[model samples]
Target: MVVVFYFAAFFVATEFALVQTRKSALESALEAGKGNRRKLQTALKMVQNLNEYLSTTQVGVTLAGIILGWIGEGTIEILIVDALRIAPISETGLHAIGAILGVMLLTYLEVVLTEIVPKNLSIDMPMKMMMLVVTPLHYFHILFYPFVWLLNVSAAAIIHLFGLRPASESNDVLTQAEILRLSRNAVTGGMLDKNDLLYMQRAFDFNDKIAKDIMVDRTSLEVVDITDSVKTVINYYLRQGFSRFPVVANNDKDKILGYVYIYDLIRQAQVDDRILVSKLLRTIITVPEVTPIQGLLQQMIQKQTPIVVVLDEYGGTSGIVTDKDIYEELFGVVKDEIDNVSSEYILKNADGSYKISGKTTLYDFERFFRTKNKNFDESESVTIAGYLLENYKVKRDDVITIGQFDLKVVDLNHNYIDWLEVRRHAASPDEQNAPQDKPAEINGQK
Candidate 1:
């Protein structure tokens, strides 16, 4: 009975430890060379053939349970009957009572000693438990190879009969959501940095974002006409300090010819000041505004173009997306030598209000405010400026009330709002129960 229960405990521990142990941990250990290489290799093999070894564990556990019940129950019942011989009970009644008590006591011991205890211990230290039991588990698996093989084939055949394919045990890949949750837990446990977690989360979000979500609007773009002289193109590049400028025909943005690199224009100007902008232009790629930035990034790499023109449904230029824009979406904003340290787009005032750039994304706004309003349709507009334009005719000092906040336009550049002052509305009884707004470390602001 004791030996059988010990084997049962071993099987239970091996089952949990193998399932819980990460394959990365095994590889890392093997690479580190801190322990017996042969044993670690065997452990890795067991993990690789997890389904086969799992069948071995199930078979071992079942056999151990059967043997324990066969030998243990009869022995325990005889002991109980002899111990309770002096009790005021008939011989038949005492035997019946002893049988019931023996089954109950055996079940209690088996559950605690062989099942729950070992399972919890293995889960708590999966790698350590796996290392401890791996050698014996490997030999047991080899001995039970025929049984494991038959069991696996039978299971597969039954599954096939039901028109379901056998799941590949090798493909234990974690989903993005699971990775995000694990990253958060790691942060909470002080095992990861918060900024690293944020980057990971943004990477997952990067694929879900479309080009228009991060593009510079056409109105804000600086371009040179295709008819412009080489000197004129150089002057435009010098004034704007941008790496590239789109070349438009007939002073029309919709009639984009291509883009000219600053270096290319400078080189041409040095050779001949009479060269037209169109002659030095590099071919630019155009993508629909709805194209996902993740796919667009691959397109940019394939075409060897760092910038692309975004077109709306009418086939006119709506905005432009650059490699820098996609980089910022994943890794946060990148600052250059010319960027002002004090000129953050989002700034908290002495009062409770916030001074935010009109170009601030609705995502950043919602993240900072710790609130999401269903009324703000992201499909209609991605930026605060665009959202305001969709519902109202904007003018300087115009106050627009959105959910939980009042946006007052502070600065306007042509038809677009450049800056806005955001003030939170007084929380209602229901609103008070929601997450309270706090200072956000976003948009290069602390």
Candidate 2:
């Protein structure tokens, strides 16, 4: 019975281990040079030809079942007959009772030790189980090579008769969508933290996002004229507390030449107080506004530049995208010493409402609201403020109702929206007491 259990467990573990062990893990192990590299390579080869190996496992499982029934049932029956000899009145009744008890005991042992225990172990520790069982399973396959080959050929012929293609196995590589689904399941099962899950999800999306979607608009950029005196440039850098500023030609921001670094300015000022801003300017790279974040990051890395000017379709400077911008998109905001910008995007008000920035992307706003606003069309604008301004032509201090939420423009910087206060409309007492046949929409979403 113990030997029968071992055969069953070997077959079960081999099936699951081959199916569940990710190809990526195998590749990583193979790349990491060590003594185990040869072992991992052998395992990868077995996994690649899993269709034949699975046929081998099927043969082992069937033989184990047959052996268990023949040896195990007979031994149990003999034991039961001896144990029940004193309680029996007739030979026929004694044999019948002994047979029934033997069958029951055999089934219990098979289900517990052979089926449940091995299957659970295989699932929980696929890699460990594979390492433990694969070597023994390999020897078993070699010993029964002829039988395994005959079984596989027979199975393929049967499949052909049914007009079905022969089964094959491939490397277990997951698509991005599949990975996201698994991550979501891991989060629900408490195997992964919510913050880590979010980062993983955003990492997948980072490549799809572009520089224009995240760059600081040109309206908010700080620029300096190339003709500015050294003292004036130093004062501008000190007052703004910024490490870098765009240097433009002839005091025209549209005619951007390059950028000036504060450290470079400080170093040059000590050697020559008469140094012009142009003499201190460093070469800045420019990228299209539509460049993918991944491509932008690669360019930055290859050029050793952290900042780039994003150009519009007409070859005009649209805005700026920095390493910080790309990093924020993937891993959330990362502030440096010179970064005095506020990290607060969503501010909760005293009246159970919220204040959000005008530049907040529509995707982020939907996450905060926890509902999609049907009134706002996603194609028209990328941000909530842009949507309101384009659709309703709202001004500062004006109140507009979007679905069930009242949006009041709380602040404005020139023509652009600065902040907005949003609140859900509450139901009247009569309406609250009345029975609702359907779900009440909150903030215009259900």
Candidate 3:
């Protein structure tokens, strides 16, 4: 029974270790050629031909089961019958009872010892287990090669006859979910930083997000008229701390012709004084709002265009997105010389909540919030202020309860909300009766 169990455990451990070990890591180990690195290199080569290697493990498991059932059950039953010989009146009845007890014990031991324990141990330290088992498993495979080859060919033939391809000889491809799980496990094992893990996960999800999700809305843009003087445009660009300005015609945003960089204006200013802003304008890429962020990023890279005007479904300029915006979406904020030390869009408070910009997307707001709030109305609006205003039907400066927090429109530009004050609910009766907290003074206003 012990020998049979050892064989079963060997197959179980080998199967998991081969599947779980990362090929890249094994390659690195082989390059280093230190410790068990050589063993891992051999192990990785075997698993690369996954179909044939897996067949060997399957054969080992089957043979172990057959041997255990043939000899193990009878051995245990005879022992039980001999031990109970003095107490039992009929030999036949005693033999029957012994057989039942023997079968139950074998099944229990097989599941616990051969299945659960080894598989879990292998998963926890796959590389280490792979190295340890590779040598013995190699010899076993070689001993059974002829038999295994015959079995594999027959299996592959049958599979092909059914109009299906056999499983690939090597399978290193991982699904998104599998990669995410591995990332999460790395985080748990302290092999990766939480923030880095988040960035990696978001990188994989970049395709799912669209330019509209992260682009700057039109109302928040500081565009310039193409008719404006270079001197005037220079001052405005410097004052606003904008790297580039959209050059529009006749003060109509919809008549945007191109864009001018602040650097270009400053450089050309030294060379010409009487130039119009239009003279310095460079062509900008235009993309639809629904374009995938990843596809847009590739287009920007291939064209060497840094800024793109995002158009709405009706073919009007909705907003603009820059390469910087895509970077922020994947890896968080990236500030430049023009960017302020503190973000104008995000303001932290003493009370543990925030005063967030109304133009900020629900995605950015949630990242700041650091907690999932599924109750927020995502259908009516994509921004925090828009969701609050539309869902609660509130006017400017109105306070509303949203999820587990209190939200107040702290600032407004016409009918559109500009800033909001958020705080956790005052749950106690005394706290509720206490003077309500006023919205924090923002942009030098009460």
The candidate maximizing TM-score is: 1
User: What is the Cα-based TM-score of model 3?
Assistant: 0.65
Candidate 1: where is the Cα deviation over 4 Å?
171-173, 189-191, 208-210, 224-244, 258-285, 288-306, 337-346, 350-446
Error of 2 at 81 (Å): 4.3
lDDT for each candidate structure: 0.84, 0.78, 0.80
Pairs of colliding residues, candidate 3: none
Task: Summarize candidate 3's per-residue lDDT along 1-446 as a digit string, tens digits.
Answer: 78899999999999898888877878877888756756776887887887788889999989998998999899989998898999935988898989999999888888899989999999989988888889988999999999899999999899999999888844457888988898899899899899988988788788789988988888877789988989998777545657678889888777779888888899989988569988888998899999999899999999887888899999888888887888887777765544432467888888787787888877556545443455543355888767766766667778887545688888877778888888876456544453321211111000
Query: Per-residue lDDT of 1-446 in model 1, one digit per residue for the tens?
Result: 78898999999999999899878888999899978888888888888888888899999999999999999999999999999999999999999999999999999999999999999999999988998999899889889999889999999999999999887766778999999898899899898999999988898798889999999888887778988998987765554456677889888989888888878877887789888877788999999999999899999999998889999999999988888888899877786532332346789899979899988877667756767666564458998899899879989998988867899999998899999999998877776676542422222110
Give the true-structure RMSD of model 1: 13.6
Superposed on all Cα atoms, the candidates' RMSDs to the truth, in angstroms, are 13.6, 15.3, 13.1
Clashing residue pairs in all predictions, respectively, total 0, 0, 0
Q: What C-alpha lDDT, on a 0 to 100 scale, does residue 59 get in candidate 2?
A: 84
lDDT of 3 at 350: 87
For model 2, residues 1-446, the per-residue Cα lDDT tens digits are: 79888888778778888778766667777787643666677778778888877777888888998999999988999899888889835878878988999999999998888888888888898877877777877888898889989888988999999999886664346799998899899899998898998988898889788989888778877789988877788887664556778889876657889888888888888888677888887888999989999999999999988788889999988988777777788777565544422338778888898888888776566545544554454457988888877877777899987655688999977878989988978655654564322211111000
TM-score of each model, paired residue for residue: 0.67, 0.62, 0.65
Q: Is candidate 1 or candidate 2 better by TM-score?
A: 1
